[model samples]
Target: MAKGQTIKVEIKRQATPDAPSYTEKFEMPYRPGLNITSVLVEIAANPVNTEGKETSAITYDSNCLEEICGSCAMLINGKARMACSALVDRLLDETKSDTITLAPLSKFPVVRDLAVDRSVLFENLKKVQAWVPIDGTYDLGPGPKQAPQIQEERYPLSNCISCTICMEVCPQFNTQTNFVGAATIAQAKLFNMDPSGSVLKEERLRALSGDGGIQECGFAQNCVQACPKQLPLTEAISDMGRDVFIQKVKDFVSR
Candidate 1:
């Protein structure tokens, strides 16, 4: 917390997906208002370990440094959070220690260092068809109007940056369970609420009725708490769960 003070960070590094992971210690001079991304940048520029050994630049992903890109999500102090907004000062204060631990999200395959393959979330979104169906071949006239209250509810759900923090925090999101986690479910809810998008409502509900679908959610509520955008994940999950159930009943009756 003073001039010349240094912060110790232990980073889990993997050169490739199949490579073994190991920890590298770094000591960076303390800088006020420094976030984890900035620290990584400094470390990259120096590429030196605590023992003064030359090392490769840390491999990671970052963009928009403002938490919008969601590419900076990683395990900081054993918690999934956006490194761009993970303030070093706050991390130190919380841990009450000089050393901070960094690792890739455990739920995904490690690409390298703090980077992991989050393509699973996107694939899940594809499964749910999380989008408004509009063929924009030509200018379609004005769309149906939505009430202000509807917008108010949908706005928060739409803020999902696809960081996969929800997936990372979810205990149900593991290799054994095909659970899609909270983000995809929230996006399904978001699109399903749109007046125009509601045309595909039944399809979306049916999509969520299958394997690795809404019913797979264990409701640990960790996704809601860990979402960087504070999306109404639990609410969306509950709504989608009910909808999925109703769809199943309707399907049974129709058959």
Candidate 2:
């Protein structure tokens, strides 16, 4: 890309959560290494539509230009992705079009233009008790050590930034089923495997046993594909599913 060349961007905007949505087009000078977030910055610098009409600066959420923050997740080119890492050149090359499309994640409630409510994922995490149960803040010296093999398995699961892309791409993640989605399942597996977090393993397994639980997964595997961190989502879900089944059996026998 060179100076004087420009990229056309189409953004889906809504003035408020209850307001109607409209599309706004803008042209920004093309620059090398420009990601979707950078394009938004340029638009903020000059909030003019394609018709040359002055407009409100595009409202979007972003922080940590790097992909680590996970707050910049949105639909880029009709797919769930992180705006901070969606490179303009690669996007244009992929579509072979001068124009790129941006929108809020489809499944989430629109908090504002390009920003959606992803609290559902956090709420799901709470449902599964996706955390190690620490009894006290008091310095209890030397916790039980984990084996190196266990550490290797837990590391990738810990990389989940709760971006909710996995949920966004899932077909089962809708109001009808109220499915907890794969992120919650993956996190359940993560904490359940922990040397200390395993204290809540039975509770986590029980939590996943009923409606909106692991059984809701269609196994489309979209979650694994859409995950920015390349987590073993399917593997975690499978393991959790097996564990949940075993937990049910154990409960039945104990009765």
Which residue ranges in model 2 land beyond 4 Å of their true spot?
none
- Report the lDDT of model 2 for residue 3: 71
Residue by residue across 94-117, what tens digits does model 1's lDDT show?
A: 999999999999889999899899
Q: Model 2 — TM-score against the truth?
A: 0.97
How high is the lDDT of residue 43 in model 1?
94
Clashing pairs in 2: none
TM-score of candidate 1 versus the correct structure, residues matched by position? 0.97
TM-score of each: 0.97, 0.97
**What C-alpha lDDT does candidate 1 achieve relative to the native structure?**
0.92
Model 1 poorest 10 in a row by lDDT: 134-143
